[model samples]
Target chain A: MSASVSPDWIAVDWGTTNLRAFAMQGGTVVDQAQSDQGMGGLTTDGFEPALRALISPWIAAGNLPVIACGMVGSRQGWVEAAYRAVPCTPLDTVLTRAPASGGLAVHVVSGLSQAAPPDVMRGEETQIAGFLQLNPGWDGVICLPGTHTKWAHLSAGEVVSFQTVMTGELFALLGQSSVLRHSLDPDGWHDAAFAEAVGDTMAHPERLAARLFGLRAGQLLQSTDGAIARARLSGLLIGSELAATKAYWLGQNLAILGTGAQARAYRDALALQGAHAIPADTDRATLAGLTAARRLLREAT
Target chain B: MSASVSPDWIAVDWGTTNLRAFAMQGGTVVDQAQSDQGMGGLTTDGFEPALRALISPWIAAGNLPVIACGMVGSRQGWVEAAYRAVPCTPLDTVLTRAPASGGLAVHVVSGLSQAAPPDVMRGEETQIAGFLQLNPGWDGVICLPGTHTKWAHLSAGEVVSFQTVMTGELFALLGQSSVLRHSLDPDGWHDAAFAEAVGDTMAHPERLAARLFGLRAGQLLQSTDGAIARARLSGLLIGSELAATKAYWLGQNLAILGTGAQARAYRDALALQGAHAIPADTDRATLAGLTAARRLLREAT
Candidate 1:
């Protein structure tokens, strides 16, 4: 808690819309801070200054070893950390060193990419690595629900393959921008409505486009509650995603990674289909993954 | 057309973001005008002023009967014209009259609504009516592609049932507002890519949410052209819609009403499936439908 005491290394999770930094002392998070200056907003030159602004107070005499992940390592990030092709371990031993200001020595963790399906992930690879770290040799699927939800097939300490579903993003766009926006209340939810919609869509996923307008139509004709509509919308998308990835989660050892409602919704949706998923903390996964990346760097060197 | 040339009647096509007025002189359009003052922008009081701004010059001492359709008849429009429940004619013999300024008498044509599966259409009903008027005793499906694409089953001069698919809106939202926005060129198109994507999704509609991210991923990994990505996005959504509405168009008398790129895409997609759809013009449908409403008004008087 004391500013005078310096951290051994800093862990950074620089994503599209937010930058999160954690001061790590012997693999434990000593202090954590976040900023709005994420990878999407910053130019190449702006990254170091943005990083310095947040972690400046914790900097000491010796150069602080900063391990970063997510979009910060993307092509548009501070430095391009080429994605490591998957069917390999989530974390690569070799780290991409980045230019940093005085008192900071930065290394970026590479993302994972799949060629056949043409999918790429940055932040989630680190999270997967952390999950694997906590449960060494864990096999099966690790579902990460967020703006761009990723379903990774893990086996024998390697990410076999993964699929990305833009469910969260679709939900946001439809609920905020599309005609459905009028019928959906941002902060409303109905458990029964959600469950029913998930069941319906999973049974007939092709009818999703037809069902979307029903949310608005229902509100207009039957005076359906906005909360119910919102829940149904969420359920419909999640159900469609579930229907698509039936090969990934059906009868597989499943664990959903995240501490957010999106993760919870996914877990609940799967539960409706009689599949139980283990809940994993996102922050813990990110921190543990970053720590694992740092270990990999040390081993490679 | 001169200022002295007054219209026998005015046909109004008012939707969410647009208000179009056609000067109809004995069933022919003498002149046409439009404004951004759509139903979405105007209140009860604002509608008359907005309507007058474009048609004030055409107003004469004799009252001009205005027949209106679309969102202008919605609850939020100038006057609420209650939806005429379907399993009946698309155009009702009765029309709801709205309060208007001197020298202008306005009548709102009722939209069609289905009770079960719950759906509603305002302006499209007019198009369907127009189509029905032109092709009297025609039975089968009428597909109107737009922001809210409609597929209606017509039999015995009545709309047996109808469904609305938000495919167009989804395409717009994903291409313009979602992460796919980065990989899609607004004006780009790839015919082969679109056809392939349509086939892929028609075969696997459940994978839609998953495939959406591929547009961006394909760009990131394979340097896929934005135009190709754009076409693929459109194809994916339309393909999903087609997959859902297989019941409506498979081995049925199909007529597509619209004279836009979207309508053309729908026809092409259907053609890919070996279903030949007769192309119909949207403006003609709307005008014909409004004229039918005017005829009904005259008969009622």
Candidate 2:
């Protein structure tokens, strides 16, 4: 399609397992679209087709400068975006622009990596940038919990360093695939059970691994309540993660970037750990980051 | 086929996932046999044929009494052997015998169940009985670790009560199905890392579920060593199970019933928990249980 006039610019926050796109006019998103056709899905189907399907309507209107973040820039992404080192902020950094096609100026954002232990992230860097953009002049610890949960330290608009957690994914696997599935009531959390487990784990963490076996044993011994066991297991794992992260990024103001159930859970956990948590809208931050990238391109030209 | 002057017996241990059989002459195993036709496998292959295949050799020799235990008594096993309540010892009970063609006596052992929290055990009862027989007057704790690991409290040749742990199966599912697999480095255990994680978990036991996210975070932050992360995860889970068991059965003499690598792992873990563990020969116990069943049959008639 030939470009007649510039349509509203769009920003896409695509990650390994989630794809979300936002329509931006001026500096805010007017409309948004989402699909499960994340980067992980594109590995099976080529990336171009997936992108085309996601934004066909916007593309048909006119060519738009689309800035994307998340897994779309990984080695496994549509195109590999270089990694920015730690202690870098999103505002000063410009996203890498892909070769423009069909009047679409596409920019795939770079993720961040640390060299010491060779840790890396692809899509979260932009989100971190977005988080820093919104919470300017804030220096503290921010946790983004999901399939791969991130605990980041930011100071003076820069992402100093971050840690990742696999809590959600582990819960899913254990719940769905293990024999413990038989014991999980799945109605909701049992507070007493959860609290007891958390208290027990916090007291004697070394027994954490061995204690997992107790779930099945409790059932066999006629001493276990399935719902309680399920909640307890959940508590043990989540509590252990919190303790580890505490050790890594201690004595920092903590902000949690998530929404709904998971965010609430994190809030409760942080409270138990005596850490204050403030919730930041992750989706909005993603859009803002992409919007900033588009504005940067416009100003450059 | 006619009845032989020598008494013939068939022994079967039908577990959830596997079925094993032994042909015996004069209280000695003549030849051993097994099939993948476990209770789990029998979902498709009905009961009669499964039993026939297991004892086909003995069927060819002459009609014999077939004694069985494990899942064969569950709703899914060959036949549901009604559960006998706890406080009952092995020698105090014998399975109900069904007379089959050619004078074969098919005896399906009864499982033990508890009413309070409503837990049950089938095959393990026989193992417990066999263990009791071998030790004669031993008392304390016996742990059988597997997809459904069992921890039993025995007193005066009686299995007082037992608990189960779904440790092995959970490990399999997490290692194979979860995204954690991508981050796992399974070379060997990292002591410092494992100890740190264990310590952290003990301090904040409630966070075990939430802490799982830190596995990914540790990988991303370059703070977690991959190989150690895997072992650490294992430690967290196993350690949790041990902690729970300790709460219920602490101060009891401990004996572990398992073979090969799993047994070794448990031995080490129990040591960490300050529990001295004696390894019980699982395979020998299986054979001993079968032999004891034969003795009981001869004495009955």
Candidate 3:
């Protein structure tokens, strides 16, 4: 998309590994920019320069309002933004705003924190907010699949409660770095094996540790193929996640807010358990949520 | 021990990450040798050089038999030794031998394989055999803890059945590489937390996945301690393993054949569930098993 003559504000989704910014004119994204200088890569003071570098061309005359989400608001990010408690409207929640050296007024969307059992999420709050905007007052469960997947219970247009599972990160670690790497197929997936593994783990989640070694043992015994092994590994991990999160999905309208294969896998796994997951693009949801936050700031001013 | 002037044979327990050799004079270990040149670090041809390098000084005039166990007999190792089916005597099970270049009559002990539910073990089989030798006619369960911890059921002086859990490896991966690394205390562990996690997971193993994320969430929420996180990580992994292998431990004389703190941890975890796990040295058991195998071969000859 082409940049508008003068944009309303810059919407930034500053995560751990990637930085994405969208130039917004009124309510639509006019121009987009990205950088690898995520919160993980930058020091305390590097966030502004990274943001400035991305939206330099779009910043023409006056100081532009920048609404950021994700780890950019964490203590490790550019500015330390305190988290908002759950069971509150993410869009309406008090955001942490900080002004950088440049002519930039920045507002960071605070993450949602749970007191019970202790859980927290940053950028996902923005996604949840955007999802809520897309379908106003749609109360159910929105499963946000990522390196750390989040299952949020949405009720009365608020994030009532949510929990996280390190599903994606664990999968990558096991499949890429663990001993089972030799047996698992890196690029293939067997639907049947994945489904069967999911069902097995869901029914008896206690056997997770025992079944994990089966991925390697099966290959040694010549009873399992690479594709099946890979699928089963994924199946078992996700299945265990589902088993822990049965309360969130049972009799609830489930929606998966994620990007690629992992998201599709989540949808498919839930489908097998009689809970069809509605899929949503993470980027779109993030943008919509940021836009809503910007509108709220406008009204507050 | 001292090297015998004229040793009868060499007992070699070669595994994926370690190479241990004990020179046997007559049903006893005389001289000992070891190297980091495990099967994992060598090609097919490198095994001979590695072995010769360690025991060449102790070699006598005749072609001395070298009884080996573990991954050195794996398909990817020195020779593709076939797996011996279980419910048979591990000491009496036929071993595959490769004729090395230096007049060394090499016998590689094949690991035990299970057909039902698909399971296999390489180095641990040797430990099982040795444990049986120490406790003749011991009809109970033997828990061998390591990277791939194994629990074998011995009945009437034979390995009736066994199961493997990636408990050790999983603990290492999560504590070292995963996000939980930041929160978990690398140098310390809390006993109370460990026991609590063990009991919690044993009762409700489904919470393992959720509890895994709790380690990270607790840190982020400032509601968790580093030492407790570390112990809980170990506890959760072991607890899940114990839950799956409950069939082997329930109302059985459980002997944990392993080395170091990990084995002790397993023993303690089992103690919580009313099952007392007797601790045994892994290296001692392996040596005993190799000696017994060499003895059986000599008698057969």
Q: What is the interface RMSD of each candidate, in Å?
A: 0.7, 5.3, 1.0
Name the runs in model 3 displaced over 4 angstroms.
Answer: A1-4, A60-62, B1-6, B60-63
lDDT at residue B207 of model 2 (Cα atoms): 50
* Model 1 Cα lDDT, one tens digit per residue, B256-298: 9988789889999999999999999889889999999899889
Decide which is better by lDDT, 1 or 3.
Answer: 1
Top-lDDT structure, candidate number: 1
> For residues A1-301, could you state the per-residue lDDT of candidate 3 as single tens digits?
4532568789999999999998888778888999899999989778788988998888856678899999998888888788788888877635677658755788898888998878989999899989988888798999998899999999998889998999889999999999999998898999999999999999999888889888888887775789999999999999999998898998899899987889988998999999987888888899989999988888887
Better of 1 and 2 by TM-score: 1
Prediction 1 global C-alpha lDDT: 0.91
Colliding pairs, model 3: none
List the pairs of residues colliding in candidate 1: none
What DockQ was computed for model 1?
0.90
lDDT (0-100) at residue B70 of candidate 1?
93
Question: Tens digit of lDDT per residue, candidate 1, span A225-246?
Answer: 9999999999999999999999
Interface DockQ per candidate: 0.90, 0.32, 0.78
Error of 2 at B259 (Å): 2.4
lDDT of 3 by residue, B1-301 (tens): 4533567889898888889888788667778889999999999779898999888867845667899998998888999788778987776646787758856789888888898768888878788888888877788899988888888888888889989898888889999999899998887889999999999999898987888988888888875889989999999999999899889899998898987789889999999999997778877888888888877777788
